[model samples]
Target: MLNKVFHLTENHTTVKTECIAGVTTFMTMAYILAVNPNILSAAGMDPTAVLLATCLASFLGTMCMGMMANLPFALSAGMGLNAFFAYTVVGNMGYPWQVALLAVLVEGVIFLVLSLTNVREALFNVIPISLKQAVSVGIGVYIAFIGLQNAGVVVNNDSTLVSLVSFTDHFRTSGICALLAIIGIFLTAVLYLKHVKGSILIGILGTWILGILCQLTGLYQVDAEAGYNSLIPTFAMTDFSKLGETFGQCFRVDFDGISIVNFIVVIFSFLFVDIFDTLGTLVGVCTKADMLDKDGKFAKIKPALLADSIATSAGAILGTSTTTTFVESSAGVAVGGRTGLTAVVTAVLFLVSMLFAPIFIAIPSFATAPALVIVGFLMFTTITEIKFSEKDYVKAIPAYLCILAMPLFYSISEGISIGVISYTLLHLICGRGKEVKPLMYILTVLFILKYIFL
Candidate 1:
């Protein structure tokens, strides 16, 4: 049975090979299960509960990917969506945590409905290839921004028009560490391109060891108690009252001074980011896996989207913010994960890690910083696939803007919004408006109006 299941010979795949692939995929993506909860917990949610929800959702989503999509890709709460949840919804919009969860739930329900009705496929078909490229590049920039911020390379500047590098003494340690990690990523890429096995793991491990040495030499101090471990397995009881409060927050139906217009803006913002983020991830990863059928549709995308939406809804109920498919699955796909078995393996690892949350918590962000940067570069490679010779700046401009603006704007949604709006206007100006689809035109106009008027 083991031999049959793991066979990888010319005639048959070996169980050992499958297990190796599964484990490799899981390790590559293990950071998501931990990082999502870490970010959400900062917004005053119970950390342990968020961790549980993250694990459960990831496992369930990945399982669905395996069972339904039958692809080797794994899924989890995404990086950009979580930032939108924490910064835009909760912080900028001034919505309470529970209400934000409710908004996520609503978005999930909408996503589920769209996926089930097969509207998702139609939506995928209309998204210009250039727009898709922009989305991927936008996400790469967003991820790089996250890495930079986490590494303390960029900080708020009170004196300048825009934020400047953090030259303060406190950030020096983190800054140096981040530079080293970036170097490690480049070296790893060179090695991997040279056909080195496990280059990512090697690069990450080397950087981590360097960080540890820095700590030992007193160049940097290690925070032994940085992450929340008590929040795992059974850390905090679910606050039922917070649920009602959160739901109210979601719709901005509060007695507080927050206005209805502001509430609508926040809700729509959540809906927009979550929808596009999932769409972009699905298209990018599926394209990489060659999963698109002759019709240019994901063969089993409905189920995968349904799983992603369901995970978001469940995550909100479990007391976290928005949940969506993670791009870390790209690493898994890049390494030759070709079945849902990879996701199942990733899920199992999350479950096991629950018992040792403290250990996971101990892994400094610097340790994972290299992986994020490297993955960003890996995804950015898709830019080469775009046809630059095309005369229509409508396509070229948006694609180029997406790659450049995401890292610069420090937001994936913002970059995409710019790209979409630019794409539409360019098409209209060039008198090539007929080439643009109606739904896409509407989405573009809506996004523009939302950003400008709202």
Candidate 2:
């Protein structure tokens, strides 16, 4: 039954290979188990609840992709979108957590409509190949930077804005967490080089054990006030009574006051970022896996996109941020995954992970930091294919800016905006505007309006 449905033989893969690919994919992305809550909790949502939602949503979302689209992609609460939800929507826009979630829901619904109507696939035709490559590389740097920051390898400096911590400071002041992170980096890299399956997962587990020893030997200090200091997974860590607190709160949208503009801005930001992120991941990963059809289009993209949209909407209702297809799903692809069986295995792992949510939530960012950094390096392999000749410099420049602007400006949307706007202007200035599509022109205008009105 499994062989017939997933076509294990037809894809030149076995059940064992699919399962390994799924496990590999899950290990690469399991950092989301900790990272999502760490980001979303700052916006006033319960970290435990976010952890639960993250797991459940990931399970459901990936399952949909596997069953409906027959794709190996996995979905989870996205890193950049979650940060945007917490820092921008709540902190900058001053919207409550419930309202932020409501914005996510609205964006997901819009995305769903677009996906179902096949508009999402059409929108991708206008995106330049350079920009597509740039998005992948940019997200690589962005995620790596996040890992470095979490591991205290990169620290905030008043004078420089950000600076690297000295090696001495890393071991002495940053304590056992930093120590574990450094060790995990070397260990995971070594294991990955040796072609070990689930190297990232093994690296995380090894670091977690070292952390436990640090705590037991009185070498690790627990900060109770900041809330995350436990070495074990526990359900008692968060308030479960607040599980459904953020659900169905879209009614809290206030159209009466000046808040209407802010609401629209927030929703628009969510929509733009989520759409592009999903598009980029789908294109980049599918292309890497050679899953794109002969016309260079994703197969069954409409259904795949609908699955993503449903995940995001379901995520908001589950009291978390935007859930979308993960770029890390490419980890499975790189390991020979070619069908929904990989996704099914990954989804089952997520479902099992929910039972150990406490351990996942308590995992200090440092332990998972190495996996992220390594995955970033892996994703960056696409950079070699971009054309950098004199004639192609216009495209290359925007692509380069897109890569740098992501980590430098600290937003994927900002990076994409910079690239698109630059691509539009350079083409027009160089008498190459004919190369830009009508859809590209429309996107350029929307981004401009975003700057002016939003």
Q: Mind giving the per-residue lDDT tens digits that candidate 2 earns over 1-454?
A: 9999988888888887788878878876777887788798899887777887888889999999999988899999987789889998888867788888888999999999999887888876567878877877887787778778887878889999998776664242365676678899899899989998767767877887888888777677676665437675566444555666665665565654437777877888888888877887776677656675654666678888989999999988888899999877876776678899999999999988876666556676787687778777876787887799998999999999999998898776788888899999999999999989888888899888888976
Candidate 1 stretches with Cα past 4 Å from truth are: 1-39, 83-95, 153-172, 223-266, 293-296, 390-392
Query: Which candidate number would show the highest TM-score if scored against the true structure?
Result: 2
Q: Estimate, for each residue in 194-264, the C-alpha lDDT of model 1 and write its tens digit.
A: 86655665666666667666666766654427421221123333333433323324344353665667666
lDDT comparing candidate 2 with the true structure: 0.81
Best by lDDT: 2
Minimum summed lDDT over a 10-residue window in model 2 is located at 167-176
lDDT of 2 at 378: 75
Candidate 2 ranges beyond 4 A from true positions: 31-47, 83-96, 170-173, 226-228, 234-242, 251-258, 293-296, 334-336
User: What's model 1's overall lDDT?
Assistant: 0.65
lDDT of 2 at 54: 84
